[model samples]
Target: MMPLRLLAALRRMLCLCLLAGPALAASPTGWPTPYTQVSGTSVDWLKTKGWWPLTVAWQPAFAGQNATVVALKANALLSRRGLDARFVPMASGVAVNAAISDGSAQLGAGGNFPLTQLVDQGAPIRVIAITAPNLKHQVIVPTASPIQSLSDFKGMQPPATIGLVLGSSAEFYFQAAAATHGLKLGRDVVLKNVSQDEQRRLPAELAAVVPWDPTATQITTDLKSGRAIDVSYPYNVYQGSFFVREALVRDVPDVALAITEALVEAELWLRLNPALAADVMAGQPELRHFSRPLLAQQLAEYNLLYKLSYLYPLGAFWGRQNTDIAMWLFVQGKLGKPLQGADYAARFADGPMTQVFDRLGWKIPARPPYIPADFWMNFVGNTLPAYDTYLTMKGPQAWPEPGDLTKPFSFAGKVHTP
Candidate 1:
């Protein structure tokens, strides 16, 4: 060698260049080799026989409800469970719905309105599980505005302009509220399309805006600039749903089950560690606009509204809610044609979630419960006691049994250490 020290430095530089070349040039089409084994299957089988790195479209628009996405990004859930999946951040359920329909994403999570729209389009999709119900969407007004309720907008001189993303669940909620208060779109108030972020600061000309949390939460609590005149509940159930392609469910049952288990476990993890989950969400670029304290509040609100359950409640309450929304949208001219909730409910692929519950040794409801026709008149508090009874209870109630949510929960015989 010319010099021992120089020769060693040259070797180190060569190694650095070699590593940098691949990193700069590599465009990965598949997950790395030697995939972790899940349910006796590996990425070897997935690549050769099944779909590898299943593309999951998750919406940050849902805020804290999408903690599962946050966990997946941190490689805390799906990777830990040996599931080869990629989490794609989407702007809203609207985008997620399109991804699922176009075959870009095999799995997606969306709210009631987008899900209904996707089903109405006759896409090859299925509702696998309910993500959450009673997610609060509200009609918010600036603190200085004189309008105290939706009724105040009725018969305005120029028809107050309400800001909201058109054809969104926010619109769905606003419409329901308008109808109840004897106001109609274009009659009492006009529409101005605005993103949820824009809704955080009500524009000068806009009278009010409709946005779901944590935008709504931020507007009302964190920013303290707006107050909600009306809310989604008692008008719309507003269930956020997790849906998948029928082909994925039919072809790769193991993959589907693993994904569901990961999601359920992620939710449990959020329940046990709301603060940590909030911190994770704050780190996401899409959600960076929201502070950790606000996210913590959103998670707290979610944990308060719904309990952890992966199984789809396929009873009349759910059926009628779905049907009612579909019918309403159809009549509102938002949909091309009318659709029965049963038309899509028939496709509720509960197999994966069912397996998750079975593995946990939890009692699964054998039959869907029936709800009286009038129970929906006051649907908020009118649900039957046994119909998804675990949902309303606090602190993560285990179905038909009590569990210690204070302790760590496990899946696949592995306790969640994080």
Candidate 2:
């Protein structure tokens, strides 16, 4: 019962892979045994779905929605490159892990943090690629807010009301910033989850806001309206990418390779097609009124963050930050247990990502003005990724209604929940 669009996309990808795969360079990793060939518009693979033989790409771009990027990538690869593949949608990082583990999904994106968590817990998930790494999730408040510094929250006094997601990278840094300045939540400040309607108003009612998943593109109206202002997180605390079960990888690594190639093309399209990027952002009713150009701006900024992380530090993400960030989280008791630096990063597969970047000759960018605010975290703060949304900033993109995750047999296949 997957969305028709999703089913169509998966069918398209599989056909492309089957058709184009044989022409691909030597598998280097070899292909799965007993592969079958088909040339129909739809797949007969799922007719008897007890872990049907298939490769699926279920990574979420930007704010973790599928169907958009996956569909676009799947179609392009199928028509132009002949990659017979399937792109599936999952609801979350947790869901992606589950699908791959359960065989409903062969592969999905899980990012460094989540991958690290699951791997440390001993799940069979393995990293096949790095969609993004070294991206710092920033913390932002209103540009004109009275909150002077990261440590100023200590004065908010009993039940201080601020806004941010409780378990995200934003909270990780907020906690770090507080500790660095000797501030404590519950004793000094408290967090309030904001609704879309309340986002523009939250800055006005609260001392300041630290939105991990902010709705507004920037603090322009909030601050211009004399509501509040904006500040940015100095560094990121949580990191995430594509994960697949080790068994699937062992059985069919070419699917992983093809997916990596398709994603590279997709990311390139997203980066270069700023004026139309929103076309690939997928459906999220909540983002209906959000400006496409603004989302594009956020995506560009997020991608640039990736460039910074990739270029400035370890030269590649390689999950080092995962160790640092996870270590910080564990010490703060955000995570259940302590994980070793080596153990945490062991889950990342930067080789694939690095291969893609190297093939493209990409390097960390020079400076900030290199991108624009709307194209960066100047809006929703750090939670917004820095990829380029292909859209004209002047026009607004209507939000598409997302599939109900609660339903059965959704396009998520056995993997929709991811």
TM per candidate comes to 0.78, 0.60
Q: What lDDT does model 2 reach? A: 0.46
Cα lDDT of model 2 by residue, 1-418, tens digit: 7899999999976765553334423221112223222333222323344434455645443342232244345345433333444556553466666776677776666545556557656777666544443233334455666666657666565556767655555566666666656667777877776532454555555665554322334444323432322332344423445565664345444444454555545544454454556655524443444455545555654442332222222212344435556676677676666666566455544454454434333332332212343533353532433532222233322111122112111111121120
What overall lDDT goes with each candidate model?
Answer: 0.67, 0.46
Question: How many pairs in model 2 have backbone atoms within 3 A of each other, for residues 3 or more apart or on separate chains, i.e. clashes?
Answer: 56
The top-ranked prediction according to lDDT is 1
Error of 1 at 361 (Å): 1.9
Off by over 4 Å in 1: 1-51, 310-317, 365-418
